[model samples]
Target: MTLNTKKDPRVAVIKTGTTYPDIKSRFGDFEAWFIRALSGNLDITVVDVAAGETPDAPGNWDGIVVTGSPAMVSDRESWSEATADWLAQAVAECVPLLGVCYGHQLLAHAFGGEVGYHPDGRETGTKQVERLAASDLDPLFANLPRTFPAQLTHRQSVLRLPPEAVLLARSAFEPHQAFRIGQCAWGVQFHPEFTEAIMGAYLDVQSPELTREGLDIDRLKAELAPAPEASGLLQQFSDLVLQMKKD
Candidate 1:
């Protein structure tokens, strides 16, 4: 669907990669998860970059949501690079944007941040996210608690943020769990769009990796719970976009 001139804040889900193959066979891709997560009263669109779908114009949509991907930002694939370039322009133009996981790293890299293999290795499963003092100033996270849990699964992390980017939240394992570049642009390293089942499924698929990493798989799975505060960000973002459009 064309994003060119929608009355509603048409948010586009830019899919950079598919869900884990096993997860995809059982559930679906990242787009479906985001759609469900947001479930906001607004027009939503899906642009599958993996399938060669790209938005016609950023001005067309009121907001954008970049989904997580399996592809590492360090790889610098042509499509990923192109999407990053487009995201930079989107931010410059004041479009409300939220990037999660791979999208988070891409947003950082697009704006001159360093993204690479995490020294501590993959951080999978539900984890605690501590909001930094600066987070109080961000509308997207002001209402969240100083400390909360969010679903996470990633090997790469944004070791450094772009110049002047606001550090919003962090976890013990991930120093840059969330950040904001421009007023309306944000990048969260955690999966705010995931459910407990999804988290458990991810742990199941990554059990070997977790086992090798010395993490207790059963304990992690049993502890998985819905991250209401983290999950609430999707709707909060939509509200922000709609409110921006109103202003």
Candidate 2:
């Protein structure tokens, strides 16, 4: 898609965590995954917030994306809390924002929503996510089918949505799978940047935990598939940013 913009939209990717050493050695880290998924239309900058990197003010960028993290939102670590504050400010400024996995929970926590460990336990592997009727009005999710596959691996979730947040999607294992706050900010519990290979690596790394939790690793591995629709969100979001810039 061609954007009618005089300049490329500036997008900031807030990096919250790194992948496991093994995964990193093979598939690169979260920022690399996001960059690949987002493609090359916009000028992307990655801020490693997990490493105490402080980004500029929210208005400086045309768009923002917060990546998944191994760290839990409930921990409220100094860097995490500070990044949450930054995200809240970005939302207040009405900047287009997308948060995935831990970033999703952090967005909820930033806006007075409750987030914690799910009583039903962790959800991992390729799973189907059903878009709610409310998604019909959402720019990012509106064109997606009612149900589509997405890669997921998380133990904590947004238990309650923030005031004025619209529920967007849900899965069998996660009720709060996706939500949007105000108009420009959205959070998704699933990983839009993960590919089939990345999911397989994750499954292999978490095999012991899956076994201990009584989840069938073999089944999850068997069910692995590419989720093009879910992964397309990054480019859609990038297009949105460029369109907004054009306007």
lDDT score, candidate 2, position 205: 98
Q: Pick the TM-score winner.
A: 2
Provide the overall lDDT of each model, using Cα atoms, as 2-decimal numbers: 0.89, 0.92
lDDT of 2: 0.92
Alpha-carbon RMSD to native, per candidate = 2.0, 3.4
- Model 1 per-residue lDDT tens digits across residues 27-91: 78788888877745668888888667778588887889999988899999989999999999999
Candidate no. 2 TM-score:
0.96
Model 1 earns a TM-score of: 0.95
lDDT of 2 by residue, 200-231 (tens): 99999999999999999989999999999999
